[model samples]
Target: MDCTNSKSVLKKLSVALIMFMFLTLTQGYQISFADSVALTNSNTVTVEAHFTTEKIRDGFYTSLVVNYNILDRSNIKPGDKIIIKLPDVCRDIKPIYKTEHFSNCTVNGDTVTLTFGPNINEGVQGYFTLYMYGNSNIKNNQNYEATVTIGNKVVKANIEGVAVDGGDSYPDMYKVFGTNFPVNNLGEGIIVDRNKPVPYTIVVNRGRKNLGTMNLKDTIPNGMALDTSSLKIYEVSPNNNYTDVTNLYLNSGRVNMNYKHLQIYFDPGNMYMVDYNTFVTSTESKYNNTATMTDYYGNVQGQAVAILGSGAGAINVYKTVDKKNIGNFGNQNIIYHIKFDSFGTFLKGTMHIQDKINPKLTDIKVTGTNQFTVKYDSATKTLDAVNDKSTIEPGDNAEITINASMKNVKPGETITNTAQVNGGDTNTVHTTKNPLIQLSKVGIDNPNHLLSGAEFEVINADNNERVSNIVTEKGNTNILITSDKPIKFELPYGNYKLVEIKAPNGYALNTKPIDFSVNANSTIINLTAKDNPTGNIKIIKTNDLKEPLQGAKFNLVKDGKVIKTGETDKEGILEFNNIEVGDYKIVEVSAPKGYEISKDTSVKVNKDQTSLVNIVDKNILGNLNITKIGNDGAKLSGAEFTVEGPNGYKQVVTTDKAGVATLNNIPWGTYTVRETKAPIGYE
Candidate 1:
């Protein structure tokens, strides 16, 4: 047969067999003490047939039958016994064989034994059904076996089943009922709100046979209410198609609502089904729900459970600076606000707020919210906010305001503070005020043409030490002054010095520092720098012998350079004009006839200043020759004469064989001669 026809035939056979079994198992059984029977399938065994548990509750008496097909087996025995064995799943056991083929069954704790009767037919094909009281649910999937013995061979048939509704639930193909949002599927923790109803889609998948007339019931936990209008049911086809059946389902007064319970009926045959929507509200802190689907046979088919809880509220702490700018250093005000926003949920816990104040500030004074207990740590400069009352219910917004101060701050400096809410989120606020310093550099001669490219250094006026890293331009440690632009600095208000470290090309450096104070207001200092004017210098070359040396050469050296070279005139004077004002050296390069050059002399020229360099070049004199005569005027070779001159001059002369002695290159002054040693007879 084709697959389609084969499936259709199998389905028809399965339905017929399910109906027959359902009638046989549930027809005569009546639970007298209980209102209804909670019969769940205990075991199923068949040959060349499919079996399933359908419409049966747990912990109920059920019937199990073993069918034997004896067409092929012909042992040809009339007195042989057929024994049947039962598992531990059944209690209060009894056996029934209508054909008189088996009888006299007895049960042990976990074993059941059966014996064959004498009326057993030679060949038979039928069922031997066992009646037993049901126990509590099984722990897990377990096996139940029935056996028959023939000579030395044993034949057994087995059925596997599981416990249900007795502390055990496992994934099984026979069971149904699930949800779109399971607690495990929704992740850990119950994070939901009742005022805001959450949706959970309940689904009932297809089973082996048609489950007739199922009643869906929901038991809501305390502090919760369900929305009746949101009840919806959808018939899901085999192709996963949805057809809304809520109108038809609820039209027959199928809904039965109690205080916290709901029951609705749905006739879901062998097809997928679903309750599309339902909403619930929780009035308390948490909510729990359990829903079940049961058939008309009083058998639970599917179940779903969930738990949800309202989350905690959020905390926000905002801080702001009161003053736009802090003009002075001490005692500035800052405001803070702590808000506990419910965010549509209730909160009950301790609220914490801590503020780490700027170390530059001190003496924290709580100006607002005197109900809060304030603590300060001077070492860390922290302020803690602790409320006396800690509990906050749902929809409760508790707010606290605080005002504090900052100290020891200066102009052009920023003071910042931060505050945290619930020891988590933090916010920082700051205030700053700057002091200005303006420096104007100008030439003394021309104030309008201010000094450009004149670098000035800033120093501490108290110690006269240079300050670093404060500059108006890159690559410069000092502030450069321009003709039209004055140098300015934003600094903390205090005492500082502006000193001209490098002057313009020709201007003189101002060595004196401009001492100034930066107070609340801005200050401007107009510094004046001067450039030296040209001056004249005259060099007078006079001989010590009271004569002017006309041919004397003079060199005027300025900064180690010969600036002017000139010879003295007839008056023994040389003059240079328009010489820059600075230190200059004048030297006689050459001397006149019979005159010696003088030493170099240094002179400093000031603005429009004239200075004279009186260099005296002495005139060289010729040697005086003297003769020591004997009686024959013979040369006195051994004569020594010492010549003494004016102005602390002295010399010595010797005589050769011609008896001559002379003194050379002496000054033109009167002198006396004396012979310390005389020749043989001359003195």
Candidate 2:
């Protein structure tokens, strides 16, 4: 009989046996079938067959054992064949038998044939194992049968299906899951974002079966679209080791995809993983996807499911200014606060922010962003910020602050600033300019009296340069504020000083400069400058001649008190500089040598002019000699006399033995002499 025809007949018999067993069970009768069968030859060959594992899973490898024995050796011969035909669900059979009994073993489909060698002996009892895989065509949760023929003898064995529903065995031949955007194995599901991508993995041939020419179809769920460019394939071993095979499989046209599904075709001799990404396209709350793996015959080998839930909500952005009004000058800070709020979902990856500021603003700085780093571009007057490591969960808010300066901006001009978050939400803030300075001038001696005709210059203290563009109420830079009118002007925010360039008539010029600062918070400033009334005094000294004296010391007395002291120059002029306007006396404290001191000369000092006083100091007269005799030209000693001279001068002198009493260094005036004591016998 033809061996190929025998395999067909054996399959029919196995099906009949199953049907008969079913009928017998229904009729309440029990019958037992032998595991061994006798051959139709004189040698009395017997064959028995069974599976090593009682239960086998579909799409997995299992071992089928067949044993044969020759009771009598009379009919043993070389070239004899033993054929084993497995059920259609079983494929890729590999035979393992002793070489002494079989010359070679060959397989066709699910059938294994063994040829006997010349060493065949009587009573030969050896078992051969056939390693095979149960294809997807097999019915699940039932017994699978196979037939064996040894020298025209046939035997059959049953393999029970694994109880997959009871969780006794691994069910699916493939597994699918998501990570990155929605991490796998997390107790709580990850929230999805439209800007984020979700990575998916489909593990095909998970049982490590040699399933030839299979296809995997992964259905993309609603609210998402497949990313074909991100698809990759990896060959995975049973030990969990991975080898990248993306380029090899993709270049060979084995992987393909569309907007809705991704398909991969491969000969899975080992386990393989298909990785790809999907972009969220909708605001749907949940997303579910399924991956199905099928063999060459279009039968589903296994299926797996993956789910992604929750989606991001709209983002809100707001901005505000710390100060609504600021000075136009430099050195003033303008703070802007920006906030971002997430209504729902989790936001990850880099968050970006951009702010465009007014051109007049300078020294831009960013702060208060704990999760972000910021940079500023002066040329563009913009701030760029990014956060790479932080995440924003549902109902969370993030804040950032920006600081800048207002410089060279015109008063009353408004500044507008706008900011955007993540290239989406935008917000704006505004600041107006308000700056002024008021100056009033008064007399230092009389603070209550406001002086006029005072000229002032505005200077920048930072650079020591004269400032321009000053807007005063009088439309001039002169700070000549008086009792009736005060000077008011506008200046940029910065450090500055006021200089008294010119003083009012009759008032002394002030040389000291007053320092001040202009800023945002203090926009208006009030100032007061003081001056003193001043005058000069001139004195002329001579010795009874119309000539100016050189060495004459004088004291300027006010209210009988010495206020100032000075010496005359070659012109005999001693000026009491910048004297207050009041009544005073110019007294000659000491005259030039050989001249008498002048009397206290009454004078007055006035504003903006000099007062002149002339004094004539007569030259010293010849020494005066007096003699007191006893009425007879005789010399008298110890005679006391009183001498009186000009300018209320009086002195007492005693005569010497020569009867001479002298008066020296006296002014030109009439004198009176009177005897106060006489000699011993004279009166």
Candidate 3:
């Protein structure tokens, strides 16, 4: 009985040990599962983000929706939280305090923490609408991505279709959003002329959201001044149509202007449009204007920005010659006037003016008002002037005078001088003296018939010296005067003679010097040099016996075109008078009754000389006869033969009843005759 008791005790102790071991293993497994829950929580949750609007303007507020789902509730506990890291460009975040799934929501810098509620369940889904302001650092027209942390797992969410800087929005107008609608938004700015008003348009409540007691404020750019008289307001409809409500707003004192700042109050009704004008007061290149909308409590709702650009003002420089300063040969003491007019903006600081004086001008002197300091560099022929202290106001004019003497300049010679302000806006002026001469070379009897390729030398009659530096119209030493235009050149005020060095083709050269005079009284002197044409073609036709052969047809060809056609007279002589002097060809079209045509003769006619062409023709004739006979000397009547001659000439002949074949009118050359067909039977 004691042994049985010991066995029973041992079994009980073994059972007890087994239970303790099972408990230890179960506890260890529970602890391991609890530790792994944090790591596996990442796979139990899903996150996604997207922008509510298709595109959000850069540096503006936009709505971002972040959706999260709890896939496995066993891994997620009441105290667990999901942390969403917002993008860097998202600033001024306005997050919801609480949602259905999360009991508390808090933001710390760029992170948003959402704590799970006590009643968290499996497959629970919720979303947070975050109103984030995209800062200027955000790249335009690009998708944004953020990271979400759930336990030890990190998930990525992307907000696509978001753009900055008015991408896919109105041009130059950055549109910002409020909780429900758009607030103060201005259109793109434009450049206007100085003192001219620039128009501006602002649209409010474009989303048609109704909010009570809305207040709008606009701050004009520093360089612009508001025009109160041009302010107008209109009520807008959902379809984007407008109704003028300026009078009602003005009478009710809803619109107020405080210098460059403007304010308007509207009772919630419909969207509104505001129109106004501002004049640019400064010469700044760019101006940025901002407008904001707020509730009655002064909580800012939305903001918009408009940019203005003032185009560079035009600075015009005009240079003119003083008409009173004149001389016989050229302007001995020429005076030039340069005027500067500032069109749209004031010229400040040192306004530089440079005048490129003509090389022919000497002794340069420039004078201006007390504001200007002038200097002249004779070596470079440049005059420089500067306005250092005084400012040239817009639409105001500044003048400077330049005095110089002309050297080595002939009469009718024009000197062009150019001046510029600030190395741009170049202006030019020209001065000329009197007594211009235009020499024309024409036909002797017809003044309208001009000639070309005539060379001449001008000599000073008093000094008997050849004149140099003669300026011609074509800038060439050899004058080419055409029928439509005459050659003009400038000479000094004195007596001069033109000696013809070479005349045009077919025109006689005038050896005598053509005398002319240039004086201050006459502005232009027209002279004509007439040339006598030479072209007479005489053709003498004769026979081989050296006797005159009459009735010979001839053609005078020039450049392959027949100029004249005639037949020789009874004396075998043909003459063409008044023909153009050039190389020509005389071709005999047909010879007299019994003679053959002569070969073509080339001849050249000289100026004022007759060209003689003597052509002789031969009256020779050749005949060919063929007789066909049998072997016994009997006549064969039906024989046929082919005759070939010079110049690829060929003919066929047949024997007649007299047994004879003949070929006539063949040129003087060797010939070949072959029997093509024999009489009747003979081959």
Candidate 4:
């Protein structure tokens, strides 16, 4: 009786332990996990391919290769038979088929190689398949794994079944043959005792290198034939998102083929535009094609429209040692990239087994010009593409532009922009050298500092007088100096000398030489001046018709007024503006030969408006026959005097373009003529 009681307790304890073990396997992990599996098994496989039982328009199908190291325990060779079963739930998919080849398989004394399908690392039996309608994307659930008998021994393994509808609930490794879906929560290691090193099954790739820019492609290397154009791949890890690196949509089934017929590839889950180039190469001729064949079943060759990398996401990370991508694309038999830049990034998360149901989804962040930077964080294993600082100035406020792929974020998520000034105090200022400004100071300090609360007096350099002209325009300007102090002063707008300084009680003056500049705030007048007749003359109202006109009024004006004025006579002209050293009455006109005048025309006498005068011969005096005073020495040879009526003209007898005719119609009044116009070209 006691023995029976002890046995009952032991049974209870065993059951509880088993139950605890089951619970732990299912619930112990808060995150997803995975590992690379090495395939080196020479197991006989039963390949059964079919479509889902319940088909809408069409049905989908997939296959799996069951791997087992059973040769050591029993006798099973090529062509040997093994019986396996599927759950009654899935009747549509058949139960058995024939095994193809022991791919990458080896009976190296005891260990075998698993080189079947695209995945070559881990032990894989064969690819289970599904059949569906034309151009239809379908999948199946391998319902259950029933007991299978191999050489009189009942072996147990989860049956690779088929289910077309439950993609949302299960992993669909159907895209890549022999590949497993769902982040491989299981880790990788030798299942057998490592101490007893059985012949190594997976060949550690010893060749093929990464070209800085060169990538993995199959066609580059001749002698290799792969099917890349028509393939459907699955996103097994990282939530099975179907996309090439750079977000470019790609056929889920095709992995790129490269040199030596090696299988190299880019990631469907990385920044497609930035980092989607892939390649593969090898040294050994025999292993070259084999390695590629074992990695991916098909080859890739076609136009690549890799979309640009996501702005907010970090560079994609891949499972590459040296240069080869692990498991072709995944563990055992798969092809893909688990890549991202290690620098300037911050986050790490593994997503797996994304299918038509569960796909890869990520939210990326981008920033405005000079707004923020990115960094990596190891503890949080997730990329944090967030703004690190604000790029704004207090006085010159700015708007931060956030360029992110949140377009899918229908309603924008609340985000913050935190800017930081590395080394600065107060408001920022954009100096001459730097266009970007930071807050450093608010406003200027001192505006004006007067002497005893009185306006500063203006001084003229010409006469040292309290002048009004020198101190006009920009009469007063405000001056700000520093932080908390300000002063006022009324000053003029002119160049000044630092004579002295005066300040209020207890406040220090601007000790640095206080030479400041003011602006000219007064309005200025500009005059465009011209005269009807201008010429060289020495005296007013002299020469020509009358030597001196007694009562003619004239004034020289610049801008508005002249500092001097004079009179003209029958010559009907006057002079102004050009005042220079010369004769008593007038001066400054550079006279023609035989005509005495200064270089500058000063008092050119002429009609104020219009006048007339009687002409005399050149050697004759004005109304006085002054030439006869030379004892009749003059002959009037150069000028023979002539007179006309009020309408008849001389010299120029008719009017021309300017409507100015020669002197005519004297009417007994003093007449005028062309003043100092020498014969054309004589000057």
Choose 1 or 3, whichever is better by TM-score: 1
* Colliding pairs, model 2: 329-492, 329-493
Model 3 per-residue lDDT tens digits across residues 483-563: 436777776678988888877777767778899987656566888887767688899998776778889998989999998
TM-score of each: 0.31, 0.38, 0.30, 0.17
* CA lDDT of each prediction against the hidden true structure: 0.51, 0.64, 0.62, 0.24
lDDT (Cα, tens digit) per residue for candidate 2, span 312-410 = 122335678988876434445788987755332222333577888788877777774555677778888778887544544323446678887776666
Better of 3 and 4 by lDDT: 3
Per-residue error at 224 for model 1, in Å?
14
RMSD for all candidates, in order, please.
27.2, 28.9, 31.9, 31.2
lDDT of 3 at 414: 74
Off by over 4 Å in 3: 1-188, 192-199, 203-215, 222-225, 234-245, 258-261, 267-273, 279-283, 292-319, 324-333, 338-353, 356-382, 385-400, 404-683
Which has the greatest TM-score? 2
Candidate 1 structure lDDT: 0.51
For model 4, the stretches where C-alpha displacement exceeds 4 angstroms are: 1-345, 348-572, 577-683
Q: Is candidate 2 or candidate 4 better by TM-score?
A: 2
Question: After superposing candidate 1, which stretches have Cα over 4 Å from the reference?
Answer: 1-433, 460-465, 473-484, 490-497, 516-683
lDDT tens digits, residues 1-683, model 1?
00111122122211111112222233322222112111111111112111112112234334444433332222323444444454555555544333234434455554545454443322222334444444655435565554545444455545444554436433211222233231321121122223334454455535424567766777655645656666667777767787887778668787787557777776657443444233443332234455677764555533333333211121223455666465332345655555443222212223456777677665555532433556767688666766544333333445555555544665456666656644343445667654545566665556667567777777877677777745342333545454557665544556787777776654556677777776655433344444344578888878775566687898888878898899999998888876667898988888886677788999997656678888887666777887877778566787888888755777788788888887667666678988878887666
* CA lDDT, candidate 3, residue 80: 82
